[model samples]
Each structure stands twice: as C-alpha cells, then as structure tokens.
Target chain A: MLHEPASQSGPDPASEFKTRLGVWMFLLYCLVYAGFVVINLVSPTTMELTVLWGMNLAVVYGMGLIIFAVILAIVYDFACRRRESALADTPAKGGKQ
Target chain B: MAITAFLIFVAFVLGLSFYLGQRTRTSSGYYAAGGQIHWVVNGVAFAGDYLSAASFLGICGMIAVAGYDGFLYSIGFLAGWIVALFVVAEPMRRLGKYTFTDAVDAKFDSRGIKLAAAISTLIVSIFYLIPQMVGAGVLVEPLLGIPHHWGVIMVGAIVITIVATAGMTSTTWVQFIKGSMLIVFSSILVAAICYRGFTTEPDQGGRVPVHEYATLAATEADSRLTVAEPGWEVVETHEDAAAKAAFAKLARDGRQTWWLISRTDDGVALKETEAVVVAANGTTLINGAPPSAENALRQVGNIEQLRGETDVKSGSISPIELLAGLSDKDTVVKRWKKASFTDADGGKATVYYPTLTRGNVLMRPGLKFKVQGTVLERLDFVSLMLALFLGTAALPHILIRYYTVPSPAAARKSTIVAIIAIGFFYVLTLFMGLGAMINAVINPADSNMAAPLLARSFNSLLFAIISAIAFSTVLGTVAGLIVAASGAVAHDFCDRYLRIPMDDRQKIRAGKLAAFSVGTLAIILGIAFKGMNVSFLVGLAFAVAASANLPAMMMLLFWKRTTAKGIAASIITGVVLSVGLICFSPMMYGQFGLDPTTAPIPFNNPGIVSIPLSFIVLVLVSLSTKNRNSGVAQPA
Candidate 1:
C-alpha cells in the first residue's frame, strides 16, 4: 500500500530508488561471495589457515556469508520502510512547487 | 517406536491437508491458496518447500563424506534466495496470476508464450521432482524396511492427494509445519551429537582384526597378496574345491581377494576370503562364521582423542571443541576414498575403502571437487555453483509461491523471512554433517543415509523422529512441485493454448487430474534414478532452471525491448540445450553403459553455456522484432 501508485500505472521515483539500492547491495554481496569461490578455486590450500575461535578459513568465511545475508535483509527492510514513510509524509502542494 | 512416530507424523499432515483443502473451492484458492496466507507463515512455508530432501539428506551426506565441498551446496542454495528476495519477489507478485508463465505472458497474448512456458515448466518441475522422489525411496529402505519403489509410490500417492485435495492451501500448511519441525529436530540431533562427543572406537566394542591382506596383484586365474604393505608376496592358486568356492563367493560380492585364516595351519595366510551371502531362502553365511548384522546398516562413532592426547577417550566435549579438535593436523580421521577397478570378469566395479586421513586434509576442499582433477572436472564444480546461485528465483515452484501471498510487499517480507529460516538451517547442516563424518555414521556405498544413520547412532527414538521429519520434508516439496506442474498443464497449456471451454470449476477439476498424472510420472522417474545422491540430482535441476528460466525472467524485468518471441525462443532453446547436454554428459554415459570419453559434453553442468546462449538469443530476437511493437514495454 505504501507504493500503491507505483504498482498501478508505471514505476515511481521511490520504487526506482529502492530498486537501485537493493541491486547495489546485492552486487556488493555478490562480490564478497565471488571472493570466497575464487579463493577456493585458485588457492584452496589457503583455506586451511586458522581463523576465529580456531575454525579454519573456509568455515569462518562460509558462516560469515550466511550471517551477512541475514544482516543485509534486515537493513534493507528498515531502510525501505523509512523511505516509504518519508515519501508518504511529503505534502502534495510542496511536491509540485 | 519409529513406525509409531512416522504414523503420527503422517496423520497430522493429512489432517491439516483435508482441513485446508476443504475450503479451497475457487480456482485461485486451489492454485495460489486464494492469496490469503499470512506473509510470515508463507515465509516459513517457503523454507519448507525449498529445503527438499537434497538440503537435508543429500547435503548432510555430502559433508559426511566430502567435508567442506559439501557445505558449498548449502552456501550456494542459501545465497540464491537473495536473488528471489531482491529481484523477482515483488515483480512476480505484481505481474503473475497462478503460475510463473502468467508473469511471462502478462503483456503478450502469444500462444508461443503459453506453449513454451508450459513445456519449460513441465521439464524443470519433473527434473526437480526426480531428486525428491529418489530421496524418498532412499529413506524408505532403511526407515520402513520396504523396497525403494514402494516408498516412491507412497510419496507419489500422498503428494497427489495433497495437491488434488486443497492445492496450494494444503501445500502451504504442510510446508510450514515440516519446515519448522526440520529445523527444530536438526538442532536437537546436533545437540545430542555434541553432548556425546567423540570416541576413538565404536561404542559397543572394538572390531577384531580377522585378517589383513596387502593386495599385490589379482587376476581371474590367480591372486598374489602380502601380509604387510611391503612384505614378501605369496601366490594363492585356487585348485581345491573349498578354495574355489570361496573365490567364487568373493567375486560374486565384488569384494577384493585378501588374506584369510588357513584351515590346514592355524595361522593367517594370503588367500582370497569368502564373502558373506544371504540365501534366497533366508539362510545366511559368512565363510565359516555365522551371519551377523554387521553386514547390514550399522552405526558409525567418532574418536575421542588423537594419536597422543592426554584426555584419551573423553566422554563429551562442546560442539566447537569437537570441530576444532578435528581440525588439528595430527588427528587421524577416517575418510572414505572411492575407486573403480577392473574385476576378474573384466567388468569395472567402484568400491570405497576407509582411508586414514589427516584431520586438516579431511576438512578441506580437495576431497570431492578435486583441485588437481581434470580441467573439465574443475569447470563442472564451478558450473554447478553458478547454477545453484542463479536458479532459485527462476524455479517454477518457487516463483509460483510468490502468488500465494496477498501483495507485493507481503511477498518481499515473506522472502526475507524465508532467507533467515533457510540460512539458519544450512548452518546447522555443517555441524550435523560433520558429526556424521567424525562418528562414522555414513555408509561408504550410499551417502544419502548419512543423516538418518547419524540420528540412529544416538537412539532409535531420535532416528524415528528424524526419518519421519525427512519424509515430511520430501512430501512438502513434492506436493509443491506437483502443484506447479499441474498448473502448467491445466492453466497454461489446456486453458490458454487449447482454448478449452471451461468454467472455474472445470479448470480446478482439470488441474487435479493433471496433478495425478505428474505424480505418477514422478514416481517412475524416482525409481529409475535410485542410488544417486539427492543433492547431485538437485544440482542438475538447478542447471536446467537457471538455463531455461532465469535469462527470460531477468530480461523481461530489466530490459524494455524484450518481445514475446524473445521470451518464448529463449525458454525453448535453454531447455533443449541443457537437457541435451546432460543426456550426453559423462555422468549419464556412466549410467548408460557407454564409455564416458565418447560423450560430447565436456562437463556435466550445462548452465555455463546454456544460460549465456539463452541471453544472446533473447537479445538478437528482441532486436530483430523491434519495430513490430507487441504493446508490452516497448522502449519506455
């Protein structure tokens, strides 16, 4: 309901901005994920390095990716909510002026 | 106790299905749960539907056997949800009606869209269904004492009932319940495994060394063996009747010839040992010894200490301590290494043996996806990861799930919740799978039994609970797939393309019949693909989905010039190419009794090629048809 007009006719400014925000964050996450894969492929032996509570590099990195996804989801939800509320608060007369 | 638990679990799911199915009268209700499900509930249901037998049994088994390489599946599958959440979740809810094809054919009234989308949906859904069914059959063998085919039939019958009765309404509730139970039960299993800790030997007793044979050379006529790895060799010629009978039994069982205790001299001698056999009339024999349950499925236990540890045979340790202790380079861990050799009959037989591996080596990547393997093998690994990463958003069953929620916002929130639930469960798989490995709870021959066997190690009660939950997991996923496949048949093909003169009531009826047919097909495929790792089959599913569906979806959403022809052509091309490559890949060649080198495809996964091919076809077709505006998103 917050972006109802965007759903009806065409893409709205707020929705477009949110899309951009999400895609950027997604790309950043992809880079981090790709780093994990590249490391495993090119220099797999490096994963044996002990890191964080004596867990191997691969374990820490794998778990870190999971935790990071959770964090991004929460952050994206709050930011979208804040943006929606901010847009809803803008006056109709001020918008045209 | 296991039967009771399994029956109670089945009864609960059936009751819920009938209750929800009764209210599902409308076509919308039957196909998409009337779009009335709560976002939170739908979110959990997504986890239930997404975490198929592959996620539970297959991933656990892979980790138990292959270590870190197995966990890669868990990571790739979870990460794919991010695509679902951010890219496809909201737009799919806004554009689609019942199936993912609805979203693709939203603007274009082209019959090509309907036909191509329907075929693609059927292919992808059936490919995905095979793994879930195979997993069902695998579970039945150990849990229910029934044959594999019978188990597949039961799952097929149960899932068809769920889909035909209530449709998405029943499917959603089943998934929600099963998903919650899967996570809770896995946590309990992991806790139990950690609390018990590791032991150097099996809990019951130590296995006595009956005979040790260092195989030097083995042929049909004669077998040469040594007492030790570098000891003097002794030739054993099969001239006597008793010795020949023992050699025949060993050959029949596909076991290697080894040293055995000599009957003439009361000492161990180099000879071919006889294999244990179960007669057709129920008699059992193992050389001169009585038949024992040791030949059957058995529990594997972990070691408590390393070669020279102070706290030898410690009773319990924290989960963190268990993994950390196992990571020590000096710790000797039992890892199974599989190899195929030419038997006496000149036939190749793949056999697995327990190899003493260093703990650090066992925990790394080279075990399954070999770093120094053939170039094609490395590419196959990367290609699989790519498919799993990109496939989640494009799957017909997963995409159709967005329509079950009420609004676009609801769909987005639901996807986030699903990511959380799925991500958490995947993390648990790491501990549960590693526990199975350290405890030696996995069968060297069949990796699919790892988790269930691991639970059996603690007690039969936990085993029953875990098996019942895994069965439900298969049920939930299969029901979702059948529902999606049926929608493609009845709605996309039957209604749109065939132009069947039918009311809403008739449409729902057609869907139920289609559901039955798809379920039957799934049962047959499940039986045929038996003995394969569920996760491996799922990887193939992901490849097809990513190749056939993802490109069309991405172009439709982001590109303004994508035409109806583009979407249809891309989907058809993607499906044909991926399936063709898989059929000719080395993996399939091995199954078909053909030389693997004769296969045209270099790697098993076709996503790396098919996905890009789909994208290029869509781009070229859309550009060629640029001037003939179809009135759907034509350059702003």
Candidate 2:
C-alpha cells in the first residue's frame, strides 16, 4: 500500500491493510460464534436437530468453528506474506510514499 | 508397573531440569530463557504450559458427565488464542522484558503501572495455581494411595524446584517435552477408544442389567426418622436437630426427598433409591451389594437403536458413527446420581443408582446449563464463555511466553503453532470424554479422575502411562505459573516498585526466593480447596484475567489515547470487582454454609459485568489524564 519498503515514519499501508483484514476476519468469526450462542439461548432444541449424517447440529457446528479458526489463521499468514512481497515489488516500481 | 512408569517420568523431568539449570546463569536466561527458544518448540511449550490439569482431567470429567456443555469450555479456551496470535503476541514480545508488567509498563515508566500490573499478575497466577494444585492432589490419591494434602505438597515442592533451579529455561524444556508426550499419548488413547468402540457395560464382554427402579419397604421406624411413603423405605435418620429439622421441613414440603434418613434403635436403614451416579473413589456398592472392584466406578454408555438395525450390544465404531449412533433418540444411555439420606440401618449413606437417558438428549446441551434456566442462569453461561474467550491473551503465564521467543515475529509464529496444537488437543478431548462416559470409567465420587480411570478400563499399562503424563501435565503448568509469579515479585514489584537495584546474581536469587514463597502458597490453597472441580476453578481464573488484564492490554495496543493511569485503574478495577463478585456469588455462599439466595451477586461468572466495567474505567480514566500522559500513547 505504500511506496516505501521498510520505513516506519507512519503506519505502513500494507500493515494497515493486514490489520483491517485481520479485524474484519475476527469479527466475521465472532458473528458466527455469537449466532451459535444466541441460537443456544433462543431455541436450544434447534442444536439437537440433525443437520448432517445422523449427527446433531451442535456437534457439526462446534467442529466447524474449530476448523474455521485454523483456516482463518492460515489465510492471514498467507495474506501477510503476499502483502510483504507486494511491498517489495512496489518499492522498485514506485508508487505513493 | 504403574509406580515404575510414574517414577521414570518424574526422574526424567528432574534430570532435564538440572541439565537446563546448568546453562541458565544470567538473570535473562533464568527469567526468559535468554530469549533463545526456537519458535516451534516455544509454541508446543505454550500448549504444555496452557493445558493444565484442568484441560486434561477436568474437561474430560465434565464431558463424561455434562456431555456437550463441557466441550464449550474447550471451544472458549481455543478461541481466546486467536486474540493472542493476532493481537497480544507480537506487541508483547516487542515491548516486554521478562514479566507481563514489563509489557504493560513499557510505554509509561510510572511506578503505579508497575505496582498495579505486578499485583494483578500475582492475583491471576495464584488463582490459576490453585486448580493445578488441587488436580495434583486428586491424582496422587488414586495413583499412589497417598493423602490429598501430601500430594499437593509434593507437587508444590517439585514445581518450586523446577522454577528455582532453571527458571524459564528448564520450565520451557519441561513444557516442550510434556506437550509432545501429552499429544502423542492422547492420540494413542483416542485410537484405543475408537478401536474398542462402545459397550453398554464398562467391561468389554459383560451385559448391562436391565434393572427397573424398585421400591423397598421399611419394616420399622424410630424417633429419629419415619417412613412417610409406603414401599419407599427411609432407612437412615439423623437425631441432630438441624439435620432432623432440614429433613422434616423438606419431607413436609413434599419436595424431592428432603428427609433422606430416619433414626432407628436397631440401626439406620437407607431409603432404597436408584440413580446414575458418577461414582467416587473406593469400591462402588451397587444395589446394596458388598463393595468390590467391579462396581467401584459407575458405568455409562449409549446403545445404538437405529430404526432398522437390531440392537448391537457392543462393537467397534468410528468417531462419526459414535456421535451419530448417540444422536439416535431410541438409543439408551445410563447416567448416575448420588443421593444422601439417613438410613434406618445405615446412618448418612450416599448411594449410586443408574438413571436411563435417551441418546439424543445426552448429545445435546442443557444437562448442566438447562435450556429452561432463568435469565441469570443464561447470563452466567454467556459470562463464562466470554471470560474463556478473552482470558488466554491476558493470562500472565501465557503473556510471559512471548518474551521467551527471540522477536515479535517469532512470538506470532509460535502463537500460531500453539493454537494448532491446543486446538487439536481440544478436539481430541471430545472423544476422550465420550469414551470415558460410555465405558463407565468415571470415578463417581471425583469426576476429575475420569480420564485416567478411563485408561484403567483398558489395561493397567495404558493407565500408568496416561496417569504419569497427567502428573507431568500438572508439573509443567505449575512450574510455568510459579515462574510467572516470581517474575512479578522479583522483577516487576521489587525492581520496579520497591526500586531494588540488584546485580544479575541477586536478581536470580530474588526470583528463586519468590518462587519458593508462591509455591508454598499454592500448596496451602490447593489443600484448602479440595473436592472442587479443577475446570470450575480455571473458569474463575479466566474471568479474573480477562476482566483485570485484557481491557488494559487491548487499550494499550489499539487505543492511541491510552494512558498509564487508565491501565492502572483498569487493572485494579478488574481484579477488585471480579474477585469481590466471586466472593459474594452463590457458589461462594454455598461454601460459606449459607443459602445461595442470600449472596448479593446473582451471577456465578463476573466477566459480563467486570469486563465492561474495566473497559469503561480505562476509557474514562485515560480521557481525564490525557493532559498528564503526553506522548505516552505514541509507540516508540
């Protein structure tokens, strides 16, 4: 996001972008989690409804949340790497400082 | 063979500690392992340090009893690491020296920040320590046949030795070894559970008796007690006025068996009742039979009764199949209940009886957190979830791990590793808990022994390995907590607050001394808090950590206007409010021998109230002191 490759005078645009992405990702996950908790409160019996191959909704959803966390972390790491590479390529091409 | 395995494990850890201690001479090496640990190893070590007795024994026990509600803790615990990885991990590594206080006080060199942060760390460390100590006591009773108090003291002494000798260096190595072993052994255990499959009885080939609840007739009664209901004999009775009064009141009220006993001249006869009791330690007496090894632990399991499928009494099943089979409503599951009543023949007898449950109901929530619970009960559940979700990043012991890695980037990478390891282990806990439940391996009296007892169901060898690993689990976690507490005392408080300028040698000395003091205190608290579930104690610890430390931490990292005063005020408020609320909570009132209704706090968990209160205090205090804290908000 910035022309400068390594300068720390202000918040690096790449870092800022990553931070924003991270926060949004976190919020997205939180929404899913909160939805689960709310459902548990509002109509808890829904958690017992079978959604998968004979398994209840709560088990499937709980397992999905755990898997989702791993996927999010992996995505963030990749994005950070891509952003680092983009910054490296940008310094040579020259853009906004 | 079990004793041998446990001995071998203890010897290996102590030997490793002394070897690591030889290399850790400087204050930095002693406190932060010289910031030289590899990120991957440090990450696994994080798992080792974080998965205390509570994670292994307590969660499994809760799952064995409460089913799905227990896994909620695992979810809450793992989710918190997301905050740790993305938020606290990097900044903490960049800012801090040794202790959590170092990180909080990095931007502002105020003495108040140091004192408040240090005290907060001590309070959290002590709170976290109690459960680990209690777990240790619980383990030793079954493993070595030693008294609970002695077991607690043994753990305290061993952990102190580990912390005092090599400090963070040895602690890290122990954690790494412990973490790896725990995962490997747990995986093996899960494989065993899936291989053996589910059975109606704890013993593989035995058949579960289809016993219906029966009524027993009391032939006689005395002044101490009388049988009000025919066929339901009241066997036990207490002559004590308070006991009689309570029983008579309950019986008169016609509520659930209030008067459990009656006093007879010949002896006390117990009210014959049937329940699904998670049996306690010792020989389990079933149907008033003689206490024997076979009936010692209460057994529970789900029977698959699919629409077309004939009843398969016992067979091997995959994890998915196990859950699916359990989800079938027609399947029967057994649960135990313990009822204490005065017996005409036996005074004050608590009997374990099996209660039949539908498989689908066992698979859902509401066993512990009822769906029809009151508003406050629901709020309490949410509050616990919030605490667990927010507590990981703010834990003093967990935060101190950031300083163990070389750089901020390493800290972040290590946190990711910790997350994966921890997350996987939590998933494994579900199968372990279910396995314990189905196999009837639970110690009915103390649910904390469920996992280890589950291992015992298979064979003595596997049981030995799992129990020894569990012992190591306690040691690794307690050692880390002690190290964190020592850093708070010798470094944060003594150096920063009291302004004790010590040479490197003296700094190490002070840290060792501090470790001893904190370890002793942990031992005492552990003994005092016997019989309480370790996971419940850990939940309280999370609430305190999230409330007392997380608000200040998040503000300092993200808020450009955060000041020292705000941080200090938030810490004090969080600690005071949460601890104070816990003291007046219904649970505490029960401990104090008073009616739960008399307690001022309606909620069991203080996180919902305390966390928000902390954030508000931080914001208000920071705005008021904005002028005095010039340039402190800007990161160097």
Candidate 1 root-mean-square deviation in Å: 5.9
Report candidate 1's fraction of native contacts: 0.31
Looking at candidate 2, what is the lDDT of residue B324?
83
Fraction of the native A-B contacts that model 2 recovers = 0.28
Task: Please report the candidate that would top DockQ against the real structure.
Answer: 1
Q: On residues B1-636, what C-alpha lDDT tens digit does candidate 2 reach at each position? A: 778998998888888888888888888898889888899999999999999999999899998877888888888888888888666776667678888888788778878888999999999999999999999998987789899999999889888988989999999999998999899989988888888875543463343453233322233433544444553433333343322222221122332232323335754433334322123434333434444665443444334344224445546678898788777777766665555544443334454444556767777777887654999988988888789889988999999898887766567778888888988999999899988877756656677788887787777788899999999999999999999999999988897789887999999999999999999999999999997757767888899999999998889978999999999999999999999999999988866668888899998899999999999999999999999885366642
Worst 10 residues of 1 chain B by lDDT: B242-251
Interface Cα RMSD, each model: 5.3, 7.2
| Runs with alpha carbons beyond 4 Å of true place in candidate 1 | A1-13, A91-97, B204-224, B228-294, B297-311, B339-342, B345-350, B634-636
lDDT (Cα, tens digit) per residue for candidate 1, span B237-259: 22233122222213223333323
Error of 1 at B268 (Å): 16
